[model samples]
Target: MATIYDVAKQAGVSPKTVSRVLNGDAPVGARTREAVEAAIRALDYRPSSAARTMRSSRSGLVGLITGAISRGDGSAGPSGLPDLFIVQAIQRVVAEAGMTLMIADTGGEADRAVELMATFAQHRAEGLIYVADSHQRIEDLDPRGTPLVLANCFDAAGTPAVLPDDRAGQRALVERVIAAGHRRIAYLTLPEGMIATELRSRGYREALEAAGIAFDPALVIEGFADHGEGPRPYIASALDRLLALEDRPSVICCGNDELALRLYGELRDRGIRVPQEISVAGYDDYRVISETLYPPLTTADLNYRGIGEAAARRLLALIAGAPAPTEAEVIGGPVCWRQSVTEH
Candidate 1:
């Protein structure tokens, strides 16, 4: 195997000069750099990453812990698909920053995170990022002095984090629905007690208040059971409650795209025509559900990719000695206007 000395000898330069050219830590004359490059190509020399790490004390690696890849088999949280989008975006940003990303899958086991962190520490990863499959609170992650960032989740320990702005997303979606002339808007929400559910519900109410529409608790209903109780547990009942109202809603805002898709079926079963009779809106603009629906659902993009990118940037900043943020950074996406929502 060709070594750096072999290339240096071939290029007629000292070993220190070769190291400078390889590391780009010091400037070399253009001609000297060109000669070193030619010698490297001729010798096909490969530098030892271990040696580089020892000299610079930087592994040039970022550790990412996530269950998104393991959940690719479709066993995801209540939101539907795994957070693969977030992971992909993180990978892109880290690569662009000239750092390698080492991913560790927890396989749906939250406890495995600590073990994974230890493994990353063993490798001397410059930073660590934990990405949750959903927006929620994560606890008990001890970074052990290595810079850490949470993506799509936040820790009470005040670790830097990037999370989807659920409240702002829901509020924006509802505001769009209101602009479409929906005064009697019914909201079919996720099960109570979830972080996203609570924030999005508040957003819905805030949007209504901003539009001068009185908030009616009667129009809000749980659209599904928590913890995967059943495939389509409460859709029919929720729809029944809304339809039975003497003053039926002109439009219904679903907690997410999955619920909106299921509600479409229930509404069809009852011979209701979408948009013509009652328009519908959804959240998480999941393309599979939103685009394939009859009229193409109007929804909000959760900006999972943006969240991931922001998380990666934050982690890199922390690695560079930036102070941790006191509050989680929130990312928001635009509302997608489609044919499903019509003027009342």
Candidate 2:
């Protein structure tokens, strides 16, 4: 609770001198500086960041708004906690640049975003970052002159953004499957409306066309909702249909690690042997599902941390009055080849 006035009084100096010593704004005698430092240590005095911000005309604080809710009772939804990997990466970079990060969660409610934005603006944050749970378009956010950056998402009106290269990531994974000698590859994609669904499906087709394989409509199935109720009945029916085809696919590519996990159980119950009768692969190398399975899964990394780092860099540049990047930053992760995929 010690203030500059207290330090000044204890040091027998004026408050202006104390400010000069603390902020190096002006020259102070060595003896006076030493006296102020001693008083600061003696009283355990902490300079008020707000006061410093007002004097310097910069807050040295960045606000981050996320969709992940932190329940006090320690509960996580089926998708587990929101992707904090990106936030952690952003924090590290921002701290390296001598700025502190202030985070607010939207509790998965989009309506709460405006309130959070207003709070950050009121606090005079140097910039703000809006991070979505996944790659998608975020709308209705008014930056209010505070430099804003989007992480793991984008805005339709062309705001600065950092996102995973969903299409390229999927293309790379499918290319890996093809390299393993799987000619007939089936894909279980995310819901039709999802941004990832469209991008990843495009990648799937691109990879097939690159390999001189004709795209097979029958092998592509839309994924079902993940209600944590084992695998959906529709998924099993879809799998059965794929398996019954005259030229059945030799490998099944899942939308994500979670879907692959559920599919693993469903495939097991049907007496299908992984990598023997059929091969499997997934996206989003979510360790809990990808690494824990009896056979580790082959999947694509989302590179969320990379996204965070890019967003931080972009925000910092914008805060420095640099021109905003014309295109969204697209980061790509490597393919994690594990035991789930087998050579044909």
Candidate 3:
């Protein structure tokens, strides 16, 4: 096996200089760095992670706790799809920052998070991040002095967090719907009591008010059951109510792509032609449904990837002794316009 000494000898540099080049703790001249790098490549020298940690006390490892990977059915919190996009984005950012990510799945049990934190601590992780499958509040997480950040979730404990701006995302999409000349817009909302449900509802109303449209309670209906309550035929029921209204809505905005996909089926059964008889839109921009729909569905991009990138950056900053954010960072994405919505 090639050693640091062998690399130093091959590069015609002192062992201390080689250490500086390898660790990047001290600056090395360009030529010296080039020589060391060349020697490392030629010898295929692999640095010992344990030895590096022993010297700098930084494991160069970030701990991530998420259920994104362990969900056997690939079902996640509201959208019913795994939050793999967020995890994938976090992985990219951590790798680009030259840090190793140690991911631990919660196995769909939130109570296992503390145990996972302990395991990561034993591995000497410099920082930790917890990612939730949906936008909600998570409580009772005690980081035990380790720098910690939350992604796609928040807590009252003031932990630095990065979350999707649900209110803004919904408002933006609705504004675009209105801009396309929609007036009597009906909303098929997620189950009540979820954080996103309330925020997005507020955004929906805000957009309507801004466009000089009166808020019609009858136009809004719950489109799904709360978690743990077996799924009911909420979409069909909601659609029936909307269609029965004295003045039917010209367009319907669904809670998420899953609901929109379901809505598409119900609309088809009712002989409704999307954007011709009635327009349809959704949230979360779950492309499998949105893009593949007969006339690609319009929706909001919740920017889960952006949330992950922000969370990873915030964790890295906290690990570097940066002050925690006074409030959670909120990330928003653009509204995607497709054939589903028409200019009335």
Candidate 4:
């Protein structure tokens, strides 16, 4: 087990310099940083997690409030980010900052989340990162004497939040679909309460309008983000309505790959041909539901990893007693194209 002093000695730098490099407290020259990094790697140096907490009055821990531990559909736990693969990456960032995590499952209930927030405060958590499976409008989260940040949940208050740039992702998707000559495109979404979902829908409509295409409210249909397991029955019923329409859309944009892929089973039951009859597209490139589907879904590769890493960086700032920048910190994303969409 190599110590910081040993690493400092190996790099021929003072222990303070090594600490600065680790904490991101000061700027080290690129060459010096590279040397310090190499010394750490060569010596297999690891920081003392306990040392950080012992030296600081702050807990060296921050709470990640989420509904991740429960099932949706009004179940007793959470179900989103963990399903989307962001939580673990979030943990990695916290660890690098020499901080620990305290996760509280809200069971997807507002009352539970409020209570949990208070409990984390009782534990003297330096700050909080409110994470959701998707974007949600949570009320009264006021930071309660602690600094707060939203992860995967954008803020209307212009507070600090980290979200995958769905606007960029969706705009690119719509542009390609338009370039392919699809004029009548429908964006199927969940309810507008979630920021990410609503933002994606807005992007979809904006893209169409920007191309001189008329926006049709009729083309957008709202469904569910989490049905816990299996497709919601309304999904099939909605597809039936679209398929039965006299002038159906040339392409359908889903809120996510899971919902987009559902079209296979839902439409196939009616013996409809994909791309031939109506092309479908999705968001959030979930591999299983996207790749292995009847036609692999063309969706957005929303950088969940980037979002998690950004969130961890924000949480670290609060933990270190640094003032958070007033400017909204945004870490944006991109798109993933598969075979689900086609030209008119």
Of models 2 and 3, which has the larger lDDT? 3
Q: Rank the candidates by lDDT, best first.
A: 1, 3, 2, 4
Local accuracy by lDDT, each model: 0.89, 0.86, 0.88, 0.74
TM-scores for all candidates? 0.89, 0.88, 0.86, 0.72
Q: Candidate 4: where are CA atoms >4 Å away?
A: 1-55, 72-84, 122-124, 142-144, 154-159, 192-194, 223-233
Candidate 2 lDDT, 203-235, residue by residue in tens: 999999999999999999975555465346757
Q: Which stretches of candidate 1 lie over 4 Å from their true place?
A: 4-44, 74-77, 226-229
- Supply the global lDDT for candidate 2: 0.86
Ranking according to TM-score, highest score first: 1, 2, 3, 4
Per-residue lDDT over 1-344 for candidate 3, one digit per residue giving the tens place of the 0 to 100 score: 89999999999999999999988889999999999999999999999978988897788999999998887465433543567888889999999999999999998899999999999988889999998888989885877778999998888887889989999999999999999988999998888888899999999999998889999999999886654544446677778899899999999998888888888888898899998999999998888888999899999999989999999999888888888889989999999999999898
Pairs of residues at least 3 apart in sequence or in different chains that clash in candidate 1: none
How does residue 25 of candidate 1 score in lDDT? 93
